[model samples]
Target: MGKCKGLLERLKNNESIVVAEGYIFEFERQGRLKAGSFVPEIVVDHPELVRKQHEEYVNAGSDVVLAFTYYGHREKLRVIGRENELETLNRKALQMARDVADRTSTLMAGNICNTTVYMRDDPEAIKKTENIFKEQIQWAVEEGADFIVAETYSDLGEAMLALQCIKKYGKGLPSVVALVPHSKDHTLDGVSFPDACKQLEDAGADVVGLNCGRGPATITPLMKEIKKVCKVPLCCLPVPYRCTPEQPTMQTLKDPKTGKQAFPVDLPAHTCGRTEIREWAEEMKALGIQYIGLCCGNASHYLREVAEAYGRSPPASRFSTDMSQHFIFGNRKDNKPYYSETLRKEITTANYK
Candidate 1:
């Protein structure tokens, strides 16, 4: 939103694309990582060092970097003793992002995830979540975030609350809201696609889009319909595969894989169809996502494939291995050089195995 006008122009231009990597520091289902206390644990114990991963994504031709603060909401941090460190943690994430974005003109999108949910969707939970936006947004501005993305929302209520908070505080910053595509193409609130976009538009979101779903084929018709009606800009995010979160990232499969262990697919898991994935990319470009990005199932090679489809070549130095076990390493945002003694010593199959 600041000092990045040319960058924004590139994005605004025809057929532009960007990719976001990771839920890295985020807590998985049911909020397993307890707030502040677990930040270090999540990073240190998560097996993958995210910085290097972010860098790898950037190398794969991604134009934007997403901060790994998806679960960094105040409430989560409060679960741990580091409620006080909320600002510190959020700011550090921005700084880490800045460090990664520093090398190239790549932009950083600060996360305001966890804004949408049900069961916990009542007024009380919403109020607590609002405070999280307040804190994180303030820190993001202070730490120089280029943009703010409230991703993976299932409903519009949390979005409304978040937008209300933005009006109350965020004077001139640009914001993005990415919805999860569910039944009827409405948010979990039953707010229809048109209605959701309008509400989010009214709520001060600069760009509105959809991400984390069954891939492009399932999303194209709705997206086309959405484009016909919406006034603001459009963005699109697609995963590498259609089936499982841990579905085989074949192009993404790692030869010297590190991070989480992969499991057998027969046991009920996330999976994405490759045909669907390729079609999704082609259709998304056709359907009009000035900014195109690949989500979870994406690896450096996967992104390179998408970029090539768009007539663009991948930037040099991208490397990623899909999980045969469990974890997949994303863009290497490690500010540290790979030639450094520490990296050379630490990056090995023996260490992880």
Candidate 2:
């Protein structure tokens, strides 16, 4: 929680936003909640890709860079047969960040996601998540992370359980819990936003915010609801992936007969990219949101655009020469030292046991 406070203190100065993001695995576009064996070329091997994303956000003026481990939550990895490699995967991701971040003031929070699927329906599912998240928090703390964000939680009970794991094994690491809102204006499991806020605050969350699901336009209304009931700083990490009834893509496609073989189709209203991120940040500022960030589709340039807007300036382009100087993706050669450190004491009562 104290680590999260580092970003909070900086916000009190002037227009400030949390330059943060979602977990980017190699197979992000492979499927929704896909549990197949991870392709080596597609995952942790590309730490440089992850590092650059974080650096670009920092350069574009993000205050925090989350390690790319959202789904690294132990139980989810277990679903894909890589559960035992959790420690190795986590340690490698953080090291990648440590190498490239030199310019801006940024901190690294280990990210713990909800189970690949919500675990609210089954008691055993719930217990599995509790154990996995607790292990993630401790491992992140040991691997030199700055804080923790238990994010993308749909069911309130699932979120509450994740928070419980953090409180139990966080070893005093500061944390923020990102809650997903339900259709009736409550948590997916039927808890009101205000009520969920109270529980998180009671459990000592340093910052509470929302991400994924809703786009920027819908988020403004949602932020208002959170502001009324929550008293801590808030972060907004939305998804970068686009969604439609059947597919989500950066560009919708159509066959072309002429110049280029293919081109993007179109997006209906209620969905947009960069423009939507700008509009959403502006709305949050109006609502007195102290912490600002992007979740899903935004890259570092996108984050910088959001940060520049927070400062009341024009959004910086990703290719501007100024950006070249600021974005640092770290030192990623074919080989680098790997670490195996554990930040927690025995889960005296092993959830596994």
Candidate 3:
């Protein structure tokens, strides 16, 4: 079959692409994967679940179906004693993603994240990391992926290595590289966010920006900084959480009731509502971020709001909220005249009581 329009062609035409990440966290929330391990063994164990998620994101208006191969690398699998299944998992994830993208007419991106074993000045660790990236890139290329997405790297070196591997093995496929910074607003190795983004662009990344970690509140300001220095398209995919300046990253957020960290789970209280996600999408558009998505705490519903904000109505938009149809807050003229004026007034003012 013929390839769909390329990512660069769409972006060059000034289109806003919505990518839906966060599969590991979303599946963990759904009880499909382990929380701490986060290895995408589901691609090998329950392939149907992976396919269903791709369908959900596509229906929710994601223009890209990024393979859920985020941490499906050598290091992570080794941790779980499943290193023998590395190639199987990566290839399975890519094939599953490609099938969904082909059926839904969305872009399929091969995904690779930080090796979690990179050292700043150690050559041996860096070499191993590059090898880890190379093997994954080979499978993505062989699977006919549309592009490669390398993300969630706290170390600039690791992110750069991922990009390098993609460029060498991707066979002309586009690359989207994103970093995940902590509270200090800099990479772990002391490079500032803006500087690291600039370096990535200079190193031939097709698109460069930030992802994961900080939420809209924190990532927006950093995107503004990166935009000023980089001429390439900037991507902004933040976690769907109400992150504040005091608690800049999700990991630092606390349970107000229990007075303990509420990251991995127990984040419902801190989750950003649909309204908040819609507003954040609007702000990202205003800031000129071309690649907009929700990271770790994302859901299809949250992304539907994002798609609506971007002015594109995918199939899922049919179910979008219409307050006029609400039983209490609705104002449709067809409502039965059963309630008296006093009752209507009381209902409207009930929240104050």
TM-score of each model, in listed order: 0.71, 0.72, 0.96
Tell me model 1's lDDT, rounded to 2 decimals. Answer: 0.61
The TM-score, computed over Cα atoms with residue i paired to residue i, of candidate 3 is 0.96
lDDT of 2 by residue, 1-353 (tens): 12234554555554465556743422354332332432222345566666666665666676666767776666656766777777888777766654444334457677787775556778887777777787777778787776777887877787778787887888877778888643345776777776877778777787787776655655556678778887777767654433332232223312333423121222222235666667767777777777677665456556665776677332244353342232132233332233211212232236674
Which pairs clash in the backbone of model 3?
none
Show model 3 residue runs off by greater than 4 Å. Answer: 1-3, 340-353
State each model's CA lDDT, in order: 0.61, 0.62, 0.91
Report the error of model 2 at residue 342, Å: 67
Candidates sorted by TM-score, descending order?
3, 2, 1
Per-residue accuracy of model 3 over 205-227 as CA lDDT, tens digit each: 98999999998888899999999
Per-residue lDDT of candidate 1, residues 242-313 (tens digit) = 432232222222222342323212211334444455556777777666767766446666666566555666
Considering summed lDDT, which 10 consecutive residues are worst modelled in model 2? Answer: 261-270
Candidate whose lDDT is highest: 3
Error of 1 at 71 (Å): 1.2
Better of 1 and 2 by TM-score: 2
C-alpha lDDT of candidate 3 relative to the true structure? 0.91
In model 1, the Cα lDDT at residue 51 comes to: 67
